[model samples]
Target: MSTMLQWPASRPARPGDPLVDSFGRVHSDLRVSLTDRCSLRCTYCMPEQGNLWLERSTLLDAAEIEAIARVAALDGVDTFRLTGGEPLLRRDLAEIVRRLAALTVGGRPVEVSMTTNGIGLAGRIDELAAAGLSRVNISLDTVRADRFAELTKRDRLADVLDGIRAAAASGLRPLKLNTVAMRGVNDDELHDLVDLAVEHGAELRFIEQMPLDAGHTWDRSTMLTRDEILETLSARWRLTEVDGRGDSPAERFHLDGGPHTVGVIAAVTAPFCGACNRLRLTADGQVRNCLFARDELDLRRVLRSELSGTERDAALDSVLRASVLGKQAGHGIDDPEFLQPGRGMNAIGG
Candidate 1:
């Protein structure tokens, strides 16, 4: 384990200097949460009831989100992934995407994508795509409705299935499906989930369930691992590694040496902190350096401040740079003293 170290204060960010952390990872990809509200309660994510939703008044408006994004855009961010309890639940999602899509940095149009639960996606995908959504990552844990209803405390599996088909037909390239691999929950349906992806022209990503549950009941000993997922896959096909893992969390592979592939995000077993280039902005406007970070920089407070435009921009840069510079070498989930973030994944943005 690497000892945690604090970086020296970063000077005001310049156009080319970018948001570089102590490990020399230039932060450009931003995960912006539109809201912490969702349409379904996935067993692995949210509680079935009693989630303390952020007040409407406290949430950042579209204009405020755009302004903060513009600052980050000017700094170096070119890719923004929209996340949420379910991004589709945000009423102004299309408008938000439109505004983000219009942002450009270094003469390159910013790429805007979303990670959604695919509940209400079918109804708004066309407008979102027209507004410049590059693609989407839809979460689908099981192909069977009974298991889906059991996993997600909702019997709306058919709705998600329809949404996936519509998104596939919406001309969104590389449509992806995210599945949190659980031990006794949906582990038996791994092959079935991948087959569902093949049927719908989507790539399946088996994520190692991290300790991000709202109920804080995640157990690493019982949680599914990447090697275990591959063991399940290797049962029926010959696996071939795909090159260019980049800074992506998923280690992708070709199954049966064909186009169909599976991505395993072994976040716990294999820490990829060295190549991480992403930062997160909570729905309420807090800048989180990592998904599991204990500390955050309040951008909403900065936005609500009385600083002039130039001053506010300077302040945003300083806070954003500070968040990056203060990043720990890894998430430290394996450390003896490791503690889960105070906020769950839904609250943190993804």
Candidate 2:
């Protein structure tokens, strides 16, 4: 763990006083990474050899994570999304969810969710839902068993499918499916994936391939853009843009004459930074204002420091404020001078 910073006492932010960046964007959604350990080695996310996982001792315990969420809730962060290389890999995740779900900000109950690869979710969906998990976003690129193995380097398509079914059966309402679309990869299975979502009454979202691969070899040439994905899907089914976008990263749409809905996150093609309201916390306790940020504030040190509860809370408020204030105007992915962050998507948490 990093050494604690010498932070002076700062006033806690009230529920109305949100964590706003320099650009006046109020951040209310927090994505916390539980761990960097994952089961599959997805080609788009990590290298085949895989990266070293963080030591268990360095990770934030369930109590520490709850404390962070409590501090965030005080500052108007109502939605907390737990993420990881694969969040289901964490054994105590249900307990963490239970703790966060008990938090209320300004009398409103905090919403707790998780984003997982769905490898181990089938058996635990009931447990997670019973523990107060509101919903889940499972990462599934293709439904074909062979394609799944080729993409993730794992033959677990059956397991993921089972998990999706379990999520719906367990009443994880508004269950979401996240697919990273690439040019010649799972792009061909777009309509099929949508069909699966429709059958399960789940919201399916196609995310553009990002440059967060561990190998740093992501080529825009091979990446499927938002327009391409929409065009392809339109050829198969009619889509109407849904109203009320409201600071969401995904552009939501509904299948014409049907109740099923789908979304596309065009991070590279259609930058949504101007309305971005999300912040990130790595498993080790670093706070990042942006997913593509080059620097982070080490809040774990303060949380683990020899300080009183009041002192730690004050320091956390200050650190969070500093990180938000330092947020860039945009991610700059489309800029000529743009460069991908050194860390991969797995390490950075989705």
Give the candidate number with the greatest lDDT. 1
Model 1 misplacement above 4 A: 1-16
**How would you encode candidate 2's per-residue C-alpha lDDT over 1-350 as one tens digit per residue?**
01112223485444336787767788889999998879898998887684777888889999999888898998888999999988998889999999999999889898899998887798898888889999999888998999889988889989898888888788877899999999888888999999998888898999988888878899999999999999999998789998888888999998985688999999988988888889999999899989898899998999889976888888888899999889998998877998888778888886
Candidate 1 lDDT by residue in tens digits, 1-350 = 11223335675445435787777678889999988888888877889898998888878988989988998998788999999978888889999999999999989899999999898889999999999999999999998889888888899999998899999999897899999998888899999999999888888999999999888888887789889999999998788999888888888899899798889998999878887888999999999999899899999999998996889888888888889889998999989998888888888887
Top candidate (TM-score): 1
Q: What is the TM-score of each predicted model, taking all chains together?
A: 0.95, 0.95
Error of 2 at 38 (Å): 0.7
Question: Against the true structure, candidate 1 has what lDDT?
Answer: 0.88
**CA lDDT, every prediction?**
0.88, 0.87
Error of 1 at 238 (Å): 1.3
What is residue 92's positional error in candidate 2, in angstroms?
0.7
